[model samples]
Target: MVSASSSTSSGVLDGFKLVRILDQDPKHKSANLLGEFASTANDGSASIDQAVLILEKTHFSEQFYRQLEDPNRAPTSDGERTIKAPKLDAEAAVLDGTERDAVFAAVSNLGQNDVYTWLLAWLQRSASDPGDADVKMTLIRPATQTHIDKYSAQRRVMVYETPEMYARKVQPWIASFPPSRIQWVYNILEHKKEADSILFEHPDTESGFIIVPDLKWDQKTTSSLYIQAIVHNRELTSLRDLTKDHIGMLQNIKDQASRVAFERYGLAGVQEGKPDGNVRCFLHYHPSYYHLHVHILAASFTSHPGAVVGQAHLLDDVMDLLRLGVDMKQRTLGYSLGTNSKLWSVLYPDGNPST
Candidate 1:
């Protein structure tokens, strides 16, 4: 009798039945196949399912050595019959490839798992402030502690403060925007996807064109999520041209935009309307980091060319824009954005906004 056993509990052939090829020929290929399977059955890496499938499809020829005694030939029962069991080699039945490749492919088929893996890696990187040199230096911390100490001392002497310290100092700049603007910028920064720098051209040849990373969660909806907006590229244009005399103008418009967006959607919910030919919409996805976001893009917006152009967009672009505006204002005023104005102060300084 020939039987097959699996080496690993998870292998395909773990509990599969092994069929025996019956034959009497000692030199036949079937005998060799059986020997091969028996010899390598405990290798622990071969897939059991594949081996069983191969065995089931294998065929062998068997010759009968004896027949029942005929009545006419009575009493001459000296003929002997022999039986042989040859196990077929599983290799002949299964596809040819490395076992490691097969298992790796199976595990990678999970899409959500892949997404989470990338998201976690990105979050870990972003957790450190972009301005932090220590965080960047940590990238090469494997050198001796003495080397690290020298590097740290040089950086401290050359630069007034660490990257983290700089970030803290500049945070007030972000906080100066109105509450609504601050929230908007925060949403965008948190959700916006980053991509390696790439060469991009403006569709209209307009100078305002700046290449920002394309952000969209799903490719199918990319056309709807992308918008043709102002970008910040110092080389392409002066800071004045980008932020320009619009500091006060942007602030005023931002207030109006926030009030309109909040009143219309935050209170009444998203309704059908043309936000400059782009349908204004609200979406809620349970699986995303930011569950609620308002989606807007011009109806005519097209894709940008880049290796990572079609990546997912954070749902909170509008919020990001507002927050960025607030940050800019804070930088200009040199003050924190979050502090609430006292009632008496508000009356004396600017009067009740409604009044």
Candidate 2:
């Protein structure tokens, strides 16, 4: 990445103004253009000629009128084309190092590449409301081999869409893949939901929402990497004679508890092992918690494995149920559950839990 000159202050004149100009051009209104520029800048690439192309494109745009405005453009005696220098907005001046650091820290915990990717995602998501620039960065999933391959060929940016929209457009195709081959898809969906829950309902208060799809979470879930890491940790712990029997007993209890929870809740679906014993596994999204849980039970619990339960999970489940009840009550009273939210409103009689 080209480092901004430390000697110069960071200002919109160097960045936003140029972008705003380009944005006004009909030809340059395409979503991917800015991202293409950004990606080019990111890879320590983008020759001077390439940068010049972007600059030239933006500099000549109709939005450039703002920077070219001149009250003193009256004809002179010589009739020469004289233009008054445009005044810059004082507030839009370059940011000091402290200010830049503050902004960067607020947006990202990861390094520059991750931040850049996140910014691209946000811009694409917020294109509909360019004036509202409050985009938050969540987590960017690591680049897949496809992403890397595509990046080599050309810059790429992933666009964000509403869950319902995304589900309609992408989920069906993704779901068609076998579970193991699409483990990353499941992880992304889970994390996206989590991110949405975090950022949802605050959109009106804030200008926009951003979700950095958690790549690490996807990696840990989709691959055997996490299990291997855990096994290594256990080996190290095993050498210390750290109450192995106690550990074994705890494991057995956990396994049994998970099985009981799964069977009682009708979660058993996939059998982890033979019929002799139950499978102890973390099932995703049971009624207990809106999370992955360790479900355990004996072999006879069911024909397959499903979800799990724990203290936290149980509490979350109860809270969600209560929340649903409250919504149902609001609907019963002929009111909506929340201001400006249409979700779960106008509940029909069939919507009642007893029904």
Candidate 3:
């Protein structure tokens, strides 16, 4: 039970008591909390019975280095890792040897990452809930028809892309995304971000992949659990690049993904093991981003967008197609793309396609 009366000075959350956590996004430091509040019978005195409280960490401490010589407050001395501060002018930030003791005192402590994690814990912590203007109703789940209409969700159509078509259409269209649009995917594969979340990884460059939880999942419920296996090969982007020669790499990734799923998440129907758990793994076409990745979602997510016909191709089917001498590059591969997308425009220039 969590009470806000003691911690709140404005009395806005004076009677609110936390009941449970509905959802959370650890990367963003935000959570959707289900709570209950007391109410009175009086017309104007009555309060809401139940409320969903959304708490989010506003931002990270980016200017922690400036903590030093911040006149109003003395320099921090939490421990090493803090950045050394310098007085700045129009041209340069000067560090005077005369202030050695002060500079050393500040540099010798924690700041940057710590300010967002621990230092504030031992010092000062604050929360601000400004009400109506500050809160947006983002907790609505099981996206309804009205929500889809209000938001104008993009409806996609299936397009069968061939090698000749890829050269004339997809390749030229996707060129705009490399090293920029999907830079974060590279950061993950290179261990720059979410390195700790990698479940399994292959050291082989050609067949290598790392499995990580999909942000759509809460990482708690096994029924709706979702994960992704991102390929280590930076140059190989999608099914359009696959050939009979890449069968071994595809098989290796699938084998490892199955291994991790069987060992980690039970109720798994892995052929090598129990053959019991219902873990469905497939690869999306026109894949989420411009990188090669496999979507491994729980069997329960039948309504998943990727579950739609022609949207996702099963890993097993893909590998078998390769084994059967089907050339993915030359084969007419069907996939969904938004109507107004550049690829769509290129594929169906005049809104009429060739049979």
The whole-model C-alpha lDDT of candidate 3 against the native structure comes to 0.63
**Which structure is stronger by TM-score: 1 or 2?**
1
- List where candidate 2 sits over 4 angstroms from the true fold: 1-56, 59-63, 73-176, 180-182, 192-355
Which regions of candidate 1 fall more than 4 Å away from where they truly are?
1-207, 210-216, 222-232, 235-273, 276-355
Against the reference, the lDDT scores of all candidates come to 0.26, 0.27, 0.63
What is the full ranking by lDDT, best candidate first? 3, 2, 1
Question: Residue 10 in model 2: shift from native, Å?
Answer: 18
Worst 10 residues of 2 by lDDT: 224-233
Lowest lDDT sum, 10 consecutive residues, model 3, at 114-123
lDDT of 1 at 109: 10
C-alpha positional error of residue 209 in candidate 2 after TM-score superposition, expressed in Å: 16
- Candidate number with greatest lDDT: 3
Give me candidate 1's TM-score against the actual structure: 0.20
lDDT of 3 by residue, 1-355 (tens): 1122322222234455666665666775666666567778756687655555455553423344465437676334534556777445523433434422221111011122311211111112223422111121232222234433333435666677777888887787877665788989889988999999998888667778899988888777777768888988888888777778777877776666666666776536645456344567787777768788988877667866666768788877888888888877777777778776666787888875763
TM-score order, best first, reads 3, 1, 2
Shift of residue 37 alpha carbon in model 3, Å: 27
Deviation from native of the Cα of residue 104 in model 2, angstroms:
30
Error of 3 at 21 (Å): 29
